[model samples]
Target: MTDSPVLRLDGVAFTYAGGAGVSGLDVSIAPGEAVALIGPNGAGKSTLLKGVLGLVPQTAGHMSFADADAAAAQRPVHAPDGMVGFLPQSAELDADFPINLEQVVMQGRYRSLGLFRWPGRADRAAVRDAIETVGLGALVKRRFGELSGGQRQRGLLARALASEPRLLLLDEPFNGLDQANRDALIDTIRRLKQRGVSVLVSTHDLELARLVCDTVVLVNGTQLASGPVDEVLTLGNVQECFEGVEVEIDEHTLVVPGHEGH
Candidate 1:
């Protein structure tokens, strides 16, 4: 990792109408590093991600992106094209949409391609590489709706990867996925880190967080703790975030009853 952080959130907060949102967030993501945001449903995990994407309103603090654009002309909340890739928890695309997998992935390039600019050879290459990276090369020609849920999830990830973003944000990606798909996503994250792409994933799976993340941020409508995974994901911290929840951990295992459903 370099001395400069790829992404930074200094005391940042996002507030929704009626006083609902998250606050007191302070995080720094280094190049090639992965950080996990662990919390239960409605704990502001998704809100935090949306805030980074500029979908929600920032009420306090500041954020900055130090990606390809050295001057950083774009505001921190207004993420530039190809600078940050986001895989939302639920996409608005129709299940029976007529689009094919390859076509779906191509949409990610549109921002960089801009208006009236057709995709050149490089764009096609990026689309292919993204599909293969998500292990969905075989299904590139298949109709998106025909694929299984896990396959669709991987396909969407490929769409996000098509942009070759410096920082990737995944919101509850492992949810509703089978063991095989879960493992595949984990592998993909590891590979992305190897390529020096920073990743921030919001999840409730402690095992996944421990396996893939270098650091973790625990939040529940407010900042709870932020630090190295091993130090922050202790019994006390877990209990504090998850009220009345049972947790068991050892050298090789992590067990949380209600939390595992995520």
Candidate 2:
């Protein structure tokens, strides 16, 4: 934890006790870097994110942010303001919950303000900024349940952005989005990178990984390969990391488009 990597997973191992567990994980993320954790379903991808976020109790290994271990942070390691924000794979909100999007986005800042305290001017400003950053300014007044799948994703992303976190962790954000929504989210991700935010996203979307990720970590509850996208996303790596896989390196796209990993 020299000088505290923005995000670090040093020998992290987690298990579900029955059969699912991740072992021998080591990874590091630096400032303003966009990284993706890619793997087959049930490969402990979501488990890894849970470990980092301190949601999973680890049987071995360590997870840290800014030099503080995950457990420590969970209790008392509140970093500088706006340190991290997480968006889960999918958030189910009451379609008729009756809250506006602005209100929903504001929840991100509520933790900093503590319970029951009203949001001050700066907090309100952050909420507005987050909405605009996600390009949901026009839709902020709409009901959360009324939104299309893509629009809801953007709104949830806006909620994450409102926290002004140093690292943003997204789980399967592109799942189920129509093409229009996917494009919008891609554009949003590009903007966030330009603003020097660190992002670690977990998804099966390989194209998204190639388009925006600076580093790729392929996992099968084990390290397959990790490093520059060009190197790690090669056909050989894909074949080994994926399940019963066969892949073709699409020259036009410069990414391994198919897989043959077993």
Candidate 3:
């Protein structure tokens, strides 16, 4: 594998029409590394992810993926043909829509296929492989609306993987998942890391971040701290990010007050 970073953002800022977004942000993720974005609500975490995906306009700074330059003036966005795969916080498919698991995954190949071109045999194989990677091969034929919450999340992940992306961006993927499904998802991430896929996950679950990510980036409108997980996720940094929320950090556990039962 090359030693270059999978993603790098220098002084990056993305703004809406009203000008709400994080600024002066800097971070990087190397190949096979997973970095967790941690912050309280309205801390611009989701906005940052949206900026990376080109959903919102990038207002300033530079972003590059795998040595490709994304100047701020160019409004660098992750194109469908780019080497980035994204799984948003909620991929709400219409329950009435009659799409199946395989079909949902196959949609990821459309960009590469271009306009009006159907998925070839190799594309179909890629879809199946992605489904298998997320442990959904047995339910490849199941309707999207029929799956459980966790299963649906995995299906979305499979969709992202179908494009054979080098960098995966996930926003709050473990929210609302049961313990069994959470563990399964964590295992899937671990396997992806082993295979040299870089990951950036935004999460409120500090425990999940510690479990799967190699680094932690704490943000409150802008970056507060970023480094190795153990160093960046200290009580001071987390408390600052959470705005004085009580946090307990043990050797292998993180407990935040007001969220104990959750």
Candidate 4:
């Protein structure tokens, strides 16, 4: 735990034009660690991710990256290319887009390659490795639109991996997956952590968090609790985070009333 953090946010807040957003944020990710962000649909989880990516404006406190050169800055807006990789909700992508699996993954290298360069040997190799890392090596040539939802999700994950990021961010990645797909994704996340990649994921799946994450951050417009998974996910903390919402918990599952279909 003494090693330098890959990313850190200390009392940071990201605000929209109206001055409303998540606040009092404080968290850090070390190499090979995984943290889960659990919350309801509009709890600012997505906003947090966007803020880290510099897609939104930061309105308070500090943000730091591992690079010593930028560590002292108030907010290291936008991590350098390849330092962070993001996999947004699947719905954001156009399923009917004409890209193939390999091509979709190749898109991840674009930021590093910049506007003038084409995919060179190293770029292609990275893309291939990423696709294989997500266990979709056999479907490289398949059309993205033709794959099953799980395969499509894996392809998107591969795209994110192509950048070889030290920190990976996934926003509600397992939302609609069947059991088999969910298992596959959990396996993929474990593999990434074993390879020393840090993961920050926002999800409603308590099972996935228990199985794959080392820590959990519960948010309801703001951070409600954050610590080791077992400690932070206690019944009282969860109930308070989802206040006014129906929540049921048993030995192996935690269910929120409106989240049955998810």
Candidate 5:
């Protein structure tokens, strides 16, 4: 509930050199709000994330984070104190990479610890605290690849949490998770919001979006409809952006085509 904005995209536009797709993406996210970006395949959900991160160059408009313009030296975007933590859809880790879970979480702390500074007792304690927050205390010594899909996701989230970011960005986090894992992660996100972390999750799961999102960002890359969940996730809006989609909401209960077949 802070008056200042943590992330802001003003009249942003990104177009591929070959004219492949995506343009005119304008959005804003405030502090302590949980927002979900929903759309179909090739809808530029990933592209938008890339744009905010400044991974892809924008042809027009501007992006500023924490009131700081995305700096040129950083390429895509830069926030001081590692103002943001991002978890990609596909986390690259070697099965026999030989990195333990504790070490993995410590990676986030590297930003605060200068390149020459080694991770000391303080860093180790912070990593332990982050691991416990994700409910992975028992598996601290386990190899990252050794955990199940859900646990692995949690571990990845723990890594993100280690950075102590005010704004968190995620791309397709629910890709390989099951019911139990999805529920657990969703709850974890809610907790983060409660603690005043701004969250932006890109997902294809309508039910999950409707459940965890306070704001829904309906994106089609070149197009975007963003607002409160009920206003943006309406039947007409969903069909218009998602195509061939049906949504029925009765008494705050949304009947989506995939989850309940409502």
Candidate 6:
């Protein structure tokens, strides 16, 4: 993979019309690098992801993808078509929906195919590959509601992968996963990195960040600190981001006071 950054944001600010959001942010994700976004509730973590996806408007700053210059003017609302994939916190799929796993993954191709067009041979192949990439090939025909929580998450991940995006954005991807599923998800993320896909994930789990990310960005409505994981995830930075909350640091382990029993 090239050494160029897949995502670049300079002094970016996004806000819902008259609503709270993030601002004055500068961040970059290089090809194959994974960056973890950490913060307390209402810290704009989800807003940042929404801004990148064009679900929210960017009120200020410059954002660009790869060689695409002046993207703020050319493509201000969102990442370029097919350049980014997003996995939201909630899939919002009805467990009773009749759609199968492969059908769900094929939805990722909708942007490229348009509403009138159908999946072609290449699109089908992409769906197959994406499912296999997440180790869900055997469950391709399973109903969406039948899979466990972790399995559903993997299925969503496969849907994201089917887009063949250079950058992937995940918001609280590990929230409901059990240990086995979490381990599998981590392995999947590792494979994505090896394949040169840059990743930006927002999560509360510091251990998860330490395990899968190369960098960490601590945010509280705005970027507090961002750098190599070891530097950015220090006791001081984390506690500062989580203001008023009790945090304990022991070697490489960090425990938030009330969350320790969880």
User: Alpha-carbon error at 203 in model 3, in Å?
Assistant: 0.3
Each prediction's whole-model lDDT (CA) = 0.86, 0.79, 0.84, 0.85, 0.78, 0.86
Q: Write the per-residue lDDT of candidate 3 for residues 163-237, one digit (tens) a residue.
A: 998889999898898988888899999999999999999988888778899999888788889999999877767
lDDT for residue 225 in candidate 2, whole number 0-100 = 80
User: Residue by residue across 72-160, what tens digits does model 6's lDDT show?
Assistant: 44456456889999999997889799999999999999989997987999999999999998889999999988999899999999999
Over 191-250, each residue of candidate 4 has an lDDT whose tens digit, in order, gives 999999999999877777889999999888788889999899887787677755654343
Q: How well is each residue in 1-262 modelled by candidate 5, as lDDT tens digits?
A: 4557788777676666776556666677888888888887888888777766767667676677876765552345546667788899987877677888998899889888988999988788878977887788999999988988888888888888898888888999988888787778888888888888899898877777678788888877666688888788777777667655443233243433432342
Among all candidates shown, the one with the greatest TM-score: 6
What TM-score, over all chains together, does every model reach?
0.89, 0.86, 0.90, 0.90, 0.86, 0.91
Give one digit per residue, the lDDT tens place, for model 1 in 171-233: 999889998888889999999999999999998788887898999999989989999999999
Error of 5 at 146 (Å): 1.5
Better of 1 and 4 by TM-score: 4
Weakest 10 consecutive residues of candidate 3 by summed lDDT: 244-253
Better of 4 and 6 by TM-score: 6
Off by over 4 Å in 3: 70-80, 246-262
Off by over 4 Å in 1: 1-3, 67-77, 245-262
